[model samples]
Target: MSESTNLREPHAQLVMAHGWLLRGRIWQPLQQQLEPQWSCWAPDLPGFGSAQRPPGLSPTLPAYGRWLAQEAKQRAAGVPLVLLGHSLGGSVVLHAAALLGDQLQGIVLLGCGGGVYQRRPFARLRQVGCALSWFQGDRRAARGLLLNSTQRRAVAGLPKLVSQLAMPSLWIGGGNDQVMQPVYVRHLAGYAPDHQIEVLPGAGHLPMRDQPAALAEVLIPWLQRLASPRS
Candidate 1:
């Protein structure tokens, strides 16, 4: 799923990961905007969309992180690689960062944060997510992802992962995002040693889809900085 146009040689590679009960196709709008400049691939994570989970792959965040890292390795084509994740996808990106090491240029997170575990809220989320997935995505994938969000290891490890990030990162939040409020986004950004946070005043959970140009306005400049030749 390389979505780059052949109009020009791409300067970098981007891998887009989607959130729970969502497929990679959700990134199409943003991919179109990035165009020939960025060689972008948005794969449906296993158990979501048309992808099937490998025989032994479990429905854990770490397992998905490994899969994402391998996917990026294959698609990198010796160019700078950046991972962009939305919501739950951001958690996956954090898990894969250390594994990608120096090959990873940077990371962009949208509507994703919160290492704190709220028991009742998480339990309610699992139930609501599972119910909604039956209509929007794979029931199995939704169940596993919802379960992962509630696990001690996944929730507790997020802050450490954010704090340990060696590469610079950008975290974006929607001012009206009820799903993951801007507060959580700022909260997590505080942990990273090198990070920038942006909030789109009119956007919500799915900014890439709802506000592509606005999202791009915040994204393109940061990407330019990353793609710049290091002295």
Candidate 2:
């Protein structure tokens, strides 16, 4: 985790959502950047981080979304809030924002997946093989899921909903991100034409780790814009 900083002075509330296989602390770098201007809250997913997984709960994405929404609502208390989500968190945020509606000021999606693209049959087979391998303690399986197109499709419904979202949003992508390919970014732009996209050159899937400063530079401006009242 990045060094802790004073957040009370920012006067703006923030909610952060982490990517898969990662906990809330994975947002440390991004949090550090926004702390000067926002009081940030990063929560662990139901089954990940410090949060205990509910027994018999389905591990599907919608279940995660519902859990996150309930948690964010308790934390937000109807205050206008800023939401920043990465990868899996991106889908979670989309669902939460749809539920929160006008209560949320804006949303930022980093290295998000889900698109109209379809994976080949062989690719699906490969993904299942890799998932099984990972279950069997193959470290390579972890890397395979991170790079698979099938995983991207699993969350495609998110962007469709986000497109109709009334609030402003910023869609950021790492220039070299393998997980959410450049084409996916374009697809996102097509869906949410009102939103802006920031591409960090030479960065990868984890831009918060690879390019913290760049992420902050883009994020700060968007947050400020959101805070400003429209004429």
Candidate 3:
């Protein structure tokens, strides 16, 4: 995990999880926009960016969830934390929530959700993933991440995780996100006990890069609301 360079006293710690095949630094623009107010930490998950996959670390969501939960806890040092995850990372957060318990103040899911496994869509996704792996830079971590995402059990377990969530949550979808459509986002949000949903118009899958300010605009007010009672 890495910390924001800014020195201001943070309102709360924000730990961001990157999507599959992406590195922690991908959150740079969003972190920059949120800095001074939020103490942002974006870790390069094993096998991506500068991090190496540990010898026994599996490619499944539960394993990754354990890894993230530990990392978030150590970094937080008892401070309240808000977990923000994008795409596959959102699924990871769902798995980690139960493990985090009270240390987690809230969760934010961006461009991620799926309770039902559409065989055709998943097949197509695997096909695209194969092509990307073959043509793009070779990273063993990419293969593992893709494997977890396409698995039926993993995708099907998302709703159960959401249903079990005891903390507040915010689910956001890109108006133009063809990858994880608004329909899926809404579907998953329905399972949450306490949740709010929002859409960023004209933004696609990578809104952190394409619409950082807009995403932050939605996040700030929500974080403030969560902080009130604790304050």
Candidate 4:
């Protein structure tokens, strides 16, 4: 068994990006599981949680992508960080990785991956996601984000980015996830080299909320892998 790490004074920083319409605090359970080994900081994606979409900034894919990379850099303070992002945030992190260059140590994509969405279900999700955001009072931001996301053609570029990556990558999914199903997660593994993939048994789309312990059960081992030198 691996030894437990101290909660305070973590050895490495873990910059977490939560899913759309979700706040950073959702990562609290997983952060606890990662304590001592990783100092975790989960940031609210713009238009979600306490963050607001700035004027003239459309909540498109690129917009969130830019915000995340900048936020992670500022928060890390010159220290390289491991980026862990969930759902839509998962997609944002990959785009951000392109700009981060070598400062990014690694990436862990949770409950998200690239693949063609099965039309109807995805449309339903878009409707629900957009409605929820509007109800929350960020109509324009939510609508724009949802519109851009529904264009599945953009998915093709997702794998290409992972293929061209400079560091390690890990992809995880909840076994029972209805959104961005595990099969899509499997699709990502096809493109990424040295990519690690795991599925938390019986978990759903929001594993960080539903099965954080199980999410962490496999998560710690993967973090340990980051410590070992890779060829």
Off by over 4 Å in 1: 1-7, 136-138
Instruction: Give residue 223's lDDT in candidate 4 (0 to 100).
Output: 77
Q: What is candidate 2's lDDT per residue for 1-231, written digit by digit as tens?
A: 232443344535688888766778877887777766587899876656467666654556655667767777788776777778898678777777777767778888998855664668436645665565454332332333344424655545656776777788888898889878766876775677468888898889988876888899988888878877789
- The collision pairs in model 4 are 6-36
Candidate rank order under lDDT: 1, 3, 4, 2
Q: Report per-prediction Cα RMSD to one decimal.
A: 3.4, 5.4, 3.9, 2.7
Best by TM-score: 1
* TM-score to native of every candidate shown: 0.93, 0.81, 0.92, 0.89
- In candidate 4, position 154 carries an lDDT of 60
| lDDT, each prediction | 0.88, 0.71, 0.88, 0.79
Q: Which stretches of candidate 3 lie over 4 Å from their true place?
A: 1-7, 134-138
Residues 1-231 of candidate 4 have per-residue lDDT tens digits of: 334434344545788888877789999888777776678898766767777778867778777788878888888888777898898788888788888877888889998886565688778878787768766457787677776877776666777877887888888988888876788899986688768889888889888887888888887877777765679
- Work out candidate 1's RMSD over C-alphas: 3.4
lDDT of 1 by residue, 176-225 (tens): 99999999999988899999999999899999899988999899899989
Q: What is the TM-score of candidate 1?
A: 0.93
The TM-score obtained by model 2 is: 0.81
TM-score of 3: 0.92
Query: For residues 22-41, could you state the per-residue lDDT of candidate 3 as single tens digits?
Result: 88998999999998778999
